[model samples]
Target: MRQTLLATSLLGLSAIMPAYAADYVIDTEKAHAFIDFRIQHLGYSWMSGRFNDFSGTFSYDAEKPEASKVDVDIDVTSVDTNFAERDKHLRERFLETDKFPKASFKSTSFKQQDDGSLMVTGDFTLHGVTHELSFPVQKVGEGADPWGGYRAGFVGETEFTISDYGINVDMLGPSSQVVYLTLSIEGIKQ
Candidate 1:
């Protein structure tokens, strides 16, 4: 929620002003923030997985939405697809987790769209390659928690291809190269 600051006037009137922005750190353990993805499998079904470990921090300003910032760090080896053998293949052959164990995102700019959604442009790093990318993020909601802390949530959606990051997809054969992602994030007010 946005808090309005009051600017007093000599006329006994008051003016509303933008609330100062605050930094919010992701309480990964409590928030259950997750990085989930879906990709075509065998040309007949969609394979889904999620990274179980990640952390991030972001600043939010409801009154000045453009001033928001975001940064995330993902543990590549934490990828979980529910199958032990497949997970091993993803870590060893596909991701090469030994050489590049981390993936990350750093925001460059924030833009609010006409539809009240946000366009976050940032550098996304995966498989040791970094590239500029933009994605849509929507504020889920914000409120006080039972623990006396305030939390805010957002959902982000983006897509990319393994080829774009120099990952070999020979095993997939004719499967779709694109990987679709759905990100759920919750930040606790610091």
Candidate 2:
């Protein structure tokens, strides 16, 4: 009878224990992740570009999603707009890649919405400046891959003015003040 009572108590304690969050590495090796951006060009058209190198990781807890976290590092010199001259100008004049060759984002909070989406807030550091940014992230899916690896994917979008990160916006014209960023991340469970 004593053994039965002890087992029952242990089981009850286990039920109240918090669930462990799963850690995942962003799948940059397989090119399953991207950090893309778009900005207005002379108020005439949208200029699109992407950073070719970046890495990140995330921790997710299905039972307590609010406790999830993410951290990412980007190679600012890897910005590619498809035009060599323009890309050079961006790296030299605007981003000043030689002085600030890296950018990063560290999530501060994650709030789950009623629609099953998440509102992610983080400190984004770019060009040596740090700012608080928030964006909504939608989970694309999560499942096991054919390679026997589990994966999860999400897409998030946010926009900010170039001046916010210490980049000059006057040269690009008023319409190009803000740059829109899109992050498509697929992570493999570790």
How well is each residue in 47-137 modelled by candidate 1, as lDDT tens digits? 9999999999999989898999999999999999999999999999989999999999999999999999999999999999998989999
**lDDT to native, each model:** 0.88, 0.95
Candidate 2 residues 1-190, lDDT tens each?
9999999999999999888889999999989999999999989999999999999999887779898899999999999999999999999999999999999999999999999999999999999999999999998989899999999999999999999899974876899999999999999999
lDDT of 2 at 12: 100
Q: What is the alpha-carbon lDDT of model 2 when measured against the actual structure?
A: 0.95
Residue pairs clashing in model 1 are none
Model 1: residues with Cα > 4 Å off, grouped in runs: 1-19
Off by over 4 Å in 2: 1-10
Clash number for every model? 0, 0
Error of 2 at 40 (Å): 0.5
